[model samples]
Target: MSQSFTTKRYRRYTEEALKDALSAVGNGMGLREAAPVFRLPRSTVLRHVEDTTQ
Candidate 1:
């Protein structure tokens, strides 16, 4: 049987972009609130913000 596969493309945010998102959240904005403005996932921002990865 022939099978077809599909892939989902994700947006790659620059370090500066992430920093902006982090700053927004740090400045008292919520994840759900900031994510849409930055066009990123709330969980993604959370991962970068909560983790020590650079």
Candidate 2:
């Protein structure tokens, strides 16, 4: 027997794009504040901010 797995495809952002999101912070916004502006999850933004490899 074989097992199958499936996952819903979600939007993906590039490094530059993520960088742009962080730009908001540099411009005087909070990390969580920038997340909404970029339409990205706060956790994801923070994770990427803390870990560049994301």
Candidate 3:
């Protein structure tokens, strides 16, 4: 027998919102603080910030 699995696919936030969150961090807002304020995931914000600085 064979089995198949499905995963949920969706983006709850927009790219503009993500940029705003990153900007907030750039302006001194903590990652933890910026995530919820912009409705973005903390890990996502951290990842982008890390990418840009590298």
Candidate 4:
């Protein structure tokens, strides 16, 4: 017997919201501080910052 594997991709925020979220970080904020304010995961916020810079 063979088993099939699947993965579910995470839902992403809108581009405009993501941009605003990261801008807060650029203005000397932190993921911990920003996440709660935006009601998002810290990792998600950090990833947005990293993605925009690249």
Q: Which numbered prediction scores highest in lDDT against the true structure?
A: 3
Arranged by lDDT with the best first, the candidates are 3, 1, 4, 2
State in Å the error of residue 24, model 2. 1.9
TM-score of each: 0.74, 0.56, 0.79, 0.60
The candidate, 3 or 4, that scores higher on TM-score is 3
Residue range with the least summed lDDT across 10 consecutive positions in model 3: 2-11
RMSD of each: 2.9, 4.6, 2.7, 3.5
Which lDDT tens digits does candidate 2 get at residues 1-54?
987988988777676667888777667789878887777778878887677545
Candidate No. with top TM-score: 3
Assess the local accuracy of residue 43 in candidate 4 as a C-alpha lDDT between 0 and 100: 87
Candidate 4 lDDT, tens digit per residue, 1-54?
Answer: 987988987766676666677888899988898877766778889876888789
Q: Which lDDT values do the candidates have, in the order given?
A: 0.85, 0.76, 0.92, 0.79
Error of 2 at 6 (Å): 9.0
Task: Tally clashes: model 3.
Answer: 0
Whole-model lDDT, model 1:
0.85
Q: Residues 1-54, candidate 3, lDDT per residue (tens digit)?
A: 887988988658999999999988999999999999999888899999999999
Backbone clash count for every predicted candidate, in the order shown: 0, 0, 0, 0
What is the C-alpha local distance difference test score of candidate 2? 0.76
Better of 1 and 4 by lDDT: 1
Structural RMSD, model 2: 4.6
